[model samples]
Target: MTRLHRRQALRLIAGATGATLATPAIIRAQTPSELKIGGMLPLSGPAAIEGHQVLKGLEFAVKEANAAGGALDREIVLMVEDDEANTTRGVIAVRKLIETDKVPFIVGTYASAVVIATMQITKEYGVPLLSGGSTSVAATDANEPGNPWFFRSWPSSVDQGLDTANAITGRFGAKTVAIIHDSGSYGYSLGDQVEQVVKDNGGEILSRDTYNAGEQDFTTLLTRIRSEKPDAVYIGGWAGDGAMIVRQATEVGLRTQFVGSGSMVSDDFIELAGPASEGFAVATLYEPSTPNVYGAEFGKRFEAEVGQAAGTLNSLGFDSTSIGIEAVRRTGGTDSKAVRDMIATGLADFPIVQGPEGATAAFDAKGSVDFPNFIAVIKDGVRTLA
Candidate 1:
């Protein structure tokens, strides 16, 4: 079954408590009592695959929390809206989630552009937005010295590019590189960062290319890049596009090592690229072989529910949602400001599953976390730590 279908089939329904009337007349009235959280995600567009994994991660965190008697002594319900990765649609979803659904906070959107667009809505309503995806440094910069309503649990593009560039130039000893990126905010930001890093380290950039997301043909670009004879090529796009690029590169006999952002470290990339994915390196925050206690448990749950091992995106969702729930539990209520403050100040030692060994979730003054990014290479169709 597809992950979307599996999501529908494996829905874990939470029971709600009913309010009882307390009066001398002894008239008992019942009302459903639950805490509602919002998710604004791209469930039906180019970014859907990324969004789906994040949703599963959000579900995993909620499932665990509810099993342990959820936050504020209430069962948590996740209400989601499909933004389709469009800024206008994302804003509408954010407003509806805040005004109509009355969700205490929102989580889980993959595209950096969408997340950046909806930030204003969440801020206007004083609702906290815990982002599990979207790594563009621009997203965090808007939050500046910490915007009260936004908290990012993902590593920034700057961090990912720095490490990946270091891996290409320092480790693999590639002195000349070609860069390709999509036009989206996340992709563009990553490509820019990687280019800067490569130049800073005294590497020569042969060429730079940009394409829209979901573009089919890369033959022309690959042929052009091959002519430049760069030592390595860095892809700053999503898995689907990355897979196609590598596959076409092989078809054109453009023999160069492939390195990319965290988005390339996925089953989708490997399965789509087939033999071409071999030797593909990516910089990412999570490695399944090295999981903390929470990560191990999350991995088992993800595999059981999603029928696949938890990857970097899933880990991102888990940590982001887990932190929000923990904040609400500590706040003793769903007051948005209280929850935001608690997350900003009280989560210094919050344990999470995504970063280095024994890693804990903590936000900097810019409302961004400092997660360690490491290089992983695909060998024999398996993503193994390098």
Candidate 2:
């Protein structure tokens, strides 16, 4: 075949020969001497412990990519910002990451509220954001415009709520469930979804209680819940507050099954309340050991790296980081929009940590993991999947 010396032929090959065919400059820019993937996680206040877990996941991905010859022949860079678990701060942090740091991609913000705020920023800039955190109905429920560039690394509350309800009522069959929340969108929204699932499944909610996130004492709610004496409790809140609720409820002699949302599966929750964390279960997207999967190996690697069992955040971070790097490579450059599209349609059955085990799905259209999640239980302060 004769080499195409025409402009139309070149344009057809690269799809818009605008700035693309500027090969030398494109390659030089593609392998950015300083390519930074921004990270925004709550590093202060109640959710600080989770920030470290998610950060470790990001670091591990960066290290792995760099060791394996990096993406697009460029070294990895990380620009981190703390959202403090506040929505306003989270949006601002992401804006800085976009305009100031000039990071083409981002991953972070554990709180759904914080991620929602950052979503506005990423949408404005058209960057591909793969969050190691953030799971709310509002975050991915884009029936109208949709979050075109927003991809989540965890399962949504809708999935978890429906699944948890099925696991509780359909599989184990919870009779009477008491729903609890911490007054944020995270707790209340998820609690509401779970409550509907239980009610739909013929289980009655004995009582629904709401508390402030930072409040250490939940004696009043615990007292009321203990009085009702439900068969099980569906707890919702940040890791810190959720831990407190469990400890207080256990102290007040509430012998109900304490089931928490995704946030409750973190090491922070267990470490904060110690023995009080026993008997609590959390529904989350990733499991440390589930046959031949990256979740188990990532958990092992993280344990070696951090000297402890990986939390929900750690498990998710590994998946998100690996997916993000691969997306960049598959797209063949650091174009944010291409990577975002790759994340959307490109992650259908793609595997991560693929030496011995199989692949891990990064994101589906709904911005979910598109994979099975385990119902992890805390028995004697150790996390084991049920």
Candidate 3:
């Protein structure tokens, strides 16, 4: 096999068992126990793209971990639930994941609002919720020691705003920009970040536009933005709505270049925005298919296995499982705390998630990984690195 294919095949294994090398050098054999991890994600709804990815990743991780004798030598039973992304339905889904499934270690709720609401319930039950999605600052910060079981894997929108703004400033050398938000927490947070980033980088803002969620119309907003003709327009919203805005913006002949977050580059967004989505730029975590030494292998394997493309944030859910299972083999346990502690402390040199050049995946103090951020622009109806 070619080196790339070999790497792809290896990554496709998603297990850390049967082979001595794949097993951690430190972890010895231990008695097996039965433990379950809950996966709360949007199986249906506007945000289902992310939900499906999280579910796949969780399942892949659990399978590999189990093959490795489970985390802490306990079987990692998975309990899956759909949050639906609606306020009430999200709350219900998380509650069911915890109470009904009796899963102490639950991962879920991709939307910030859902995470916020569900965190309250998880906190009440003393269950550890390592969220696979939702990067709103609220996920990590309630400023209370009351609930320590919450953690997030994605970079906070606050930090992303700064990163994005800096990137924009460096690229454009423009002095002014406009902010557009979808009036949702995720969109607002992204706009807020971009606005701050623009200001920080010596760029002035002309206006900040806000719209309601599920809005398929953007002629007014585009007209206003087009009239002002800011150097660039920064929009932050999920793929579905963002796609609509992009399509409308193009139809209205809005001349400004668009910059947005990763949520604007999903299956739903791609399908909805169609050709209008092209040429828009975004900042995101992973890019699987982008040509890179490390990620190229995994990227190819991902496509071969799933029969679809993976993005720069480059996981359709299996990456999480791969990392978790490897951690289990290394720590020799399935205990939530044990797996968590080992991942936090011993995962420095680990290579579970791959990124482009010089990109690493070490978890920071907040128990989040060092994900890469790439700027991708739409070209001919596809997101391509700019």
Per-residue error (Å), model 2, residue 329: 1.3
Lowest lDDT block of 10, candidate 1: 6-15
Question: How many residue pairs of model 3 clash at the backbone?
Answer: 12
- Answer with 1 or 2, whichever has the higher TM-score: 1
Model 2: per-residue Cα lDDT over 342-365, one tens digit each: 887777666743212444454544
Better of 2 and 3 by lDDT: 2
The window of 10 residues in a row where model 2 has the poorest summed lDDT is 6-15
Q: What TM-score should be assigned to candidate 2?
A: 0.86
TM-score of each: 0.89, 0.86, 0.80
* Each prediction's whole-model lDDT (CA): 0.78, 0.71, 0.64
Error of 1 at 373 (Å): 0.3
**Each model's total of backbone clashes:** 0, 1, 12
Model 2 spans > 4 angstroms off: 1-32, 143-147, 170-172, 352-359
Model 1 vs. true fold: TM: 0.89
